[model samples]
Each structure stands twice: as C-alpha cells, then as structure tokens.
Target: MFDSEIRYIISSGQRKKPICQNIVLLQQWLLEQGRCVVCGSFLTKGEKKPFGTGLKIICSCNQVYFYLPLANLYKRLSQNLYKL
Candidate 1:
C-alpha cells in the first residue's frame, strides 16, 4: 500500500520533489503505519526501546521523523516501446 502511494506521488509528477519538508507530513506518514508519530516506533512493540531509524529521530517517549528516502524520488514517464 505504501509503495503504491509513493509510486503514485512520484509517478504523477515525475519531478524531483522532496517527499516531505516539514514535521507534520512526516508525522502523518508514520501515523498511517500505526506508529507513534512522536516516537516513530510501532505501537505493537510494547515496552521496548524505540529504536529509531537513526539517532536524529529519537525523542522523549515519542519520535520526530526527520528523514525518509522519498525525497528526490523521480520516475521516468517515458516508455521505449520500440525494440532495437
């Protein structure tokens, strides 16, 4: 599901647009994944330390999503239908 959404966003524009540039957007993405937007950890991982993707996102009790590779993602819309 996530892949498709990402693909749609990238495919439609076909431009190198940063996937996210603010905290709100990041939190929304994490929330959709059932993760604590502030902590950036799966809610199912009870009592376990929130091992964030990197030290940058770690925060008190919750996480602050800082980075996601979606940025700079671009897809070429052209398809070379002709065969050599």
Candidate 2:
C-alpha cells in the first residue's frame, strides 16, 4: 500500500490564509469505485474543459478539486481523507 500526505494552501486576499492537510491512501476501495466522487464523468484525466484545459471536480458541497494529468480518481480521492 502507498501512502502520501497532501497539503493545500488557499489565499484569503489578506496576509492570513488557511491551510488544509490530508492523507492519500492508495487502496482497492478507490480502484473499485470506478467513478468520480464529485462527478460521474468516467474519472479520466484525459477529460478536458471547453476552454482546452483539464477538467476539475466540483462537489455539491461547493468543494473544488483538481486531478493531475493522466491521474485517476484515486488521486483525487485523497481530498476526502482530509480532517479539516
């Protein structure tokens, strides 16, 4: 099993900002899901936006996540492992 820690930085326009941390658990749970947790778009990194950029995951809870090129949904699932 592969495990990695992920960190995200958000700008609040001011000097103060918020930081979020998460762990990426590479396991079969994600592999068997076979669908985007945010959107059921077949979870392919090849998917692109109309503007010719990579597609992003927009959750119903208003959370925005991005998947790296050629990455699968498993990579994006790491975001859900965050503890706020």
Candidate 3:
C-alpha cells in the first residue's frame, strides 16, 4: 500500500512528489510491519538521520533500500538550474 502510493506519486508527475518526510513515514510504517522491504524476511532500521532527501534501511537479507523523493528530484534540479 505504501509502496504503491509512492509509485502513484511518481506516475502522477503533477506537482506532488514523495518528500523526505513521507519516506521517513514509510520507513516507520515498514518498521511496524516488521518485514523487510527487499526480501520480506525481516526488517532492521538503521540509526541514521535523513540526509539530503532520502532514507536508508537494511533488510535481514542484507539488502539495502534507499527511499528518495520522486517529484522532489526534478524540483531540486529545476531549483539548481535557477541558481545557475
């Protein structure tokens, strides 16, 4: 459900994107689920503050999942262009 919502945000491509906060929320949700995001074995949250615009999580399968905002990516790029 959460993953699907993130995908929807990407597919929408309108004016909304998955922000860092949203990703954080997703991580929390996944933690509650107690399931890995990669192999669905088990989930282990890494203790690290959100840097830039992404979150990092490790699964029991030794798989790492990084959640980054979708729309914010382009928005950030456009902002950078304006600075140039």
Candidate 4:
C-alpha cells in the first residue's frame, strides 16, 4: 500500500513541484512501519533536528532523515541567506 503510493509519488512530477506533501506521506508510512529502516530498532519521532537548510527527523538508532515541509525549507533557506 505505502510502497505503491511512494512509487507513484517518485515516478510522478513530485520533484519538479513542491515536495512537502509527498514527503509527509512518506514519513507517515515510514513511521507506520514501526521500525527503523536502518538499524531496525523501534522507530520513534525524535526531537526536531536540522538537516542541511531544512529540518529533519531522527530515529532511535540515530539515523537522521530529511523531513521538512516545502514552505519551511524555503523560509529556512531565505533566513540563512540573510545571515550571510
């Protein structure tokens, strides 16, 4: 179910457009899996963390993943540009 959705999103025009919605869907599916895709430890949403110019999610096994809304990513990048 989730795999098909993910595949559809990937094979579609998702990347060319904003990806937040698709990313959220993928995240939900990953969480529903109930285990880390990496070390296989039980997966839990960690405290908000950073990933490049976006926010990320961390698992119990310390695997970090890119997980930010498109709006947030744009806002974050704009803010960082101002800091320079």
Q: Pick the candidate with the highest TM-score.
A: 4
In model 2, the Cα lDDT at residue 8 comes to: 39
Per residue, candidate 4 scores C-alpha lDDT tens digits across 18-74 of 356666655555545644555655434554556666565556655654444564221
**How accurate locally, in lDDT, is each candidate?**
0.41, 0.39, 0.46, 0.49
What tens-digit string does per-residue lDDT give for candidate 3 at 1-84? 787575546524666555665676665665456555445454334332244576444444545444454532211122223222
Please list the residue runs of candidate 3 whose C-alpha ends up more than 4 Å from where it truly belongs after superposition: 1-18, 37-40, 43-60, 63-84
Error of 4 at 75 (Å): 19
**Model 1, range 50-74, lDDT digits (tens) per residue?**
2233112333464333323344121
Give all TM-scores, in the order shown.
0.29, 0.26, 0.29, 0.31
Cα error of candidate 2 at position 50, Å: 5.5
- Best-to-worst ranking by lDDT: 4, 3, 1, 2
